[model samples]
Target: MNTVQEAKRYLDNAREILREKAHKEEGYYLDTKYVKMAGHTAYVGVLVALDGLLGKKGKGRKGVDWYNQQLSGLDKRPLRSFVGAYDTLHLSMSYDGNPLASVAAAGLAEAETIIKWVESRTVEA
Candidate 1:
């Protein structure tokens, strides 16, 4: 598959894992692994999908800038905020010991929004 399709598949699989975790008792806390995995998957998948769609680079600082520029139209700034929030949360989880509670919340919200955004785009395409 192409990068966009691969990324979309990852995000879709992540969403399914997240939903299963969300159904459990203690949910988010009990299924921290799924949450963490989903967060990372969504972050990378969304960035790759965005880069593919916008015809830009697919990683690093330039990739982030490309995403921000492509999503400069939302009223509440959901797209840009989602990307930034997920990136920050990913960094914290991957490097800074534990992921902060607030960052987790932000990442979860961002993940959900990004899935929604991708769905809409898929429908449009």
Candidate 2:
């Protein structure tokens, strides 16, 4: 499968992780581990879609800054979405393990926005 398809699959898996594993109660996920896993899965999906659009770097992994610089040259809208996704999915949820369902929803929305943007620019792989 192509990068976009793989990325979408990652997103699907992330959602399943949250729905099936992360126990939601009182508007919050009770399991931090599942939340973190879902967040990381979704974040990687965003990166995978971006890599398809922007081309993958060789060797060492690139940071968000590099992505920002490259995306800034392309369009400001996706760049903005990328920033939100990075902060919400990567930092708040993935690293800090935020359990807020609303926060995860927002982050996922932002991830979707970026993925859709990438979709517009790329053909199926």
Candidate 3:
């Protein structure tokens, strides 16, 4: 599939995972391990979305540092939100197991926004 298609797939998959697994249900008990898994899955989707954006720009697949550098040069607001999402969702929640629900929610929202922005810029051939 093309980059835009790939990005949309990742975003859709992420949304499904978040809705079915990551999000906590009211008055329902969720396992910590499952929560952690959900966080990791969500973060992978974010990375895939970034990869799609960069690939569309002919940047090839690169690491997160490259993504950070590109974002820093391209736009400040999304860059800030991307960094925040990386810190809280990728590092704190995915790795450290200390993600505040509100913070994770916000980070996921930011990721969704960034993915949409990237999609808007995609020029399908």
Candidate 1, pairs of clashing residues: none
Tens digit of lDDT per residue, candidate 1, span 1-125? 66557766866775676566634443233456666776677677666655555564565566555556667754346566655655654665334423344555566566556656665666687
| Candidate scoring better on TM-score of 2 and 3 | 2
Backbone clash count, each prediction separately: 0, 0, 0
Cα distance off (Å), candidate 2, residue 7: 0.7
True-structure RMSD for candidate 1: 4.9
Provide the clash count, candidate 3.
Answer: 0
Candidate 3 residue lDDT tens string, 94-121:
6765535665576667777776766676
Q: Pick the candidate with the highest lDDT.
A: 2
Stretches off by above 4 angstroms in model 1 are 1-5, 8-39, 57-61, 73-76, 100-102
TM-score versus the correct structure, for each prediction:
0.54, 0.94, 0.71
Q: Where's the lowest-lDDT run of ten residues in candidate 2?
A: 116-125
Q: What is the lDDT, from 0 to 100, of the residue 3 in candidate 1?
A: 57
Query: Model 2, 1-125: lDDT tens per residue?
Result: 98888988999999999999999999999999999999999999999999988887776889999999999999999999999999999999999999999999999999999998999888553
